[model samples]
Target chain A: MTLQSSPRAFDPSGTEEFAHWLDGVRAWAGTAAPDMSGWRSGAALDLLALPVARGEGGAGAGFLATCRAFETAGEGAVLSGNNVLGGFLFAMSAHLWACQEPLLAFGTDEQRAAYLPDMMAGKVCGAFGATEDGAGSDVMSMRTRAVRTDTEGWCLNGVKTFVTNAPTADLFLVLARTSEHDSYGSLSAFLVPRSSPGLSVGSATEIVGPAGARTAVVRLADVTVGEQACLGGEGAGFAVLMHAMRHERAFILAPAVGLMAGMLRRTVEHARRRSQFGRPIATYDAVRERLVDAALHLAAAQDVLRATAGSADLDELDQARAALTKLHVSREFNALSNRLADVYGGYAMMPDTGIPQLIHDALASRFYSGTDDMQTKIIAEGLGL
Target chain B: MTVDDGVLTVIREAVHKAAPAFDGDDETQLITQQVLDSLAVLKVASRLENQLGVPIRDAELLPRNFASISAMRAFLATKGC
Candidate 1:
């Protein structure tokens, strides 16, 4: 007997066009090579442009549609051997959520005209340079400096680590300290081209899951750009980052939901086929309970992500809800992955089963887009606690 | 934007609730004085949104708008709250 997993139902508009677009995404994922060249050849970067306005060289698919695209890509990645495509997909999504969205939301007319077209068309790739060795959740502590120069712009000097897509990106949205005072208002965001003098990208950092993500360290030594490169104005980096993170933290788990859904479907099929104690394991209450729990978890996570992404505004309340959503979804994804792994027992450790890769991806989700503790703090502040 | 006493009272209450540790006067600098951090400002914004029935836009969430109770009152007056 075949146990079939249903397609995702929260299409926002519930239109045939949207479903077709998702099917196309799934088809690409099924066949695309798990590398940068494959992404470009498949026109996958155009899919990341979904949230930009139509006039801005994008499909204008809105945030929920973009989340759905990520979800579909996630399921496709899992079904196509997550160990190879997981990290690569994550890097692309990070570009969408962290780099592209902020530029779309806050870029000046000139900046948008200069970059969005090629970025959306997949001709150019972008990366976010925010995290530093000394700074992670406490972003204000970053030591990257953007000193005002006598030339037409500012001189930047510092290093950013754990930057996704750093190795292959053509442009970087970097956050630097522009003020002497240690305040939120001290930082600023800049659009620095990778070809800038005194800029360098180190080798990719090997991570547990998402093997091809190409996370690397970026270094800037006396790199300079025109004043026009400053995004959202000087001293607005904190606000810019917060605005981008509100969207990211809310829907970052969409892919995880897809991954969990795919993993659960696979586990159920295995349970039905793999017999133990002279009967199919699917007949056992313990195995069925694990499957049921994973389904419940996936359902709750999907609902939370949908509710948070459904909103068009990024107000204070929405910011709080985004944090709560990230917190709950990441934790649930991790727990559900472990429970699903139990059904596989020793085979769960095998790389070919893809369970280990999913488990590792689940573990990594907790740390990205701010950790669980940071989310709790944001939620608490939202409650005025 | 001259604010009425009622509006000032509501703003002050929201500010106090957001930063209970702050015991300064209405003219004191909330952000510069570090009485309200970024998260506390968000809390104050949320409270003001509920109390005043006006949605605060992202542009108005700047530190200048929430520097003090007097500042918040002026900002709210502009919002027609």
Candidate 2:
């Protein structure tokens, strides 16, 4: 049984259009099959293309609608035991935040015309190459260099780690230093194709959770591209990344919301079915309290996510709101997972029970986008402290 | 184009509030000079948006726009503030 909270309940806008779009996503996600081949399933592609403009081959849904879709997809993944589809949703959402959103916001007309159609169709996959071993939160410390060529364009050489979708990505939005100086203006973003002569993707890194996501190290050695490849101009990498992070952090926890809801659903069902001491375990104060607490945390997280996604639509979502949303939602999700584990008893440790997967994915949520510490710093600074 | 002294005053107040330790003139590079980090830049944008009643778009959050008080004024003028 699903939670009492309908998909429409999380939608703060309350428009019929958004409600209808969410319904469509729920129906599609319910029946969509998992594809472990690293390519996006057709049904998944349809959902991924929802937020793009109709002219760009999408359903013309807005940001809030897209986030709700991700949340629904997460719930569906839990019900169906399809972590592959869940991983695809996560990776594709990264594509939207890092590649699609940036292109829509800052890419030139030719760049959009060249990339958007195939990207929307899932004919090409894009990965974000920003994080490095040396520079995770310290982005300005990135050692990737893009030196100018004697002819035209520039040559890039660097290593980007933790690149999601790197194994199957046809394109990568690589951020590199254009100037030797270690400053914000020194960096630039480049859209390098996987077919580039000096570009290679390393074997996928085995992450603890999000089992199907193909993250790996991407290496570029003197990879050259034209001036047209420069996104948001020569010195705008910082701005591009900031813009992406604001939206990314705001919406990244959507799947966790769904996962928590799903975990609650399963735990409640198990409690009702599993009997102890001549009664159902759900009747006991200990089990019931855990269930109630999980529900409360889920409700609070849903509200925060809705508010943050709405702010993004209004273009008023700042770093503080985004960080707070990430911080609150992820912490609640992790906590809920632990409580549910207690309710599941020994079954929680078994692979078949699904509690272990839920716990792992929930833990992984706190680290992605930014750690809790990073979010706190952003919120504190946003307060003008 | 000339910038109004009033606009400059608002910019100065917002920057100072965002970065209480910042001590610079209108020509001082707030971004390049490292007086304001990325989060501080957002705080400045938010404060300016409230004081000037003009919304700052994400695309407009470039370092060049917040490089200095003068650059901010020039940006505001473009926004028809």
User: Where does candidate 1 clash, by residue pair?
Assistant: A87-A210
TM-score, every prediction: 0.91, 0.91
Alpha-carbon shift of residue A78 in model 2 (angstroms): 1.1
* Tens-place lDDT digits, model 1, residues A70-156: 778778767766546666677777777788778887889999989887787677788999999999998888999999989879999
The two-chain DockQ for each candidate, comma-separated, is 0.37, 0.46
lDDT of 2 by residue, A39-140 (tens): 345323355566666666565656677777788877766766664455666777778787777877889999888888778767788888999999998888
Position A233, candidate 1: lDDT? 86
For model 2, report DockQ.
Answer: 0.46
Off by over 4 Å in 2: A1-39, A42-45, A55-57, B1-4, B17-23
> Of the native A-B interface contacts, what share survives in model 1?
0.07
Residue A303 local lDDT, model 2: 92
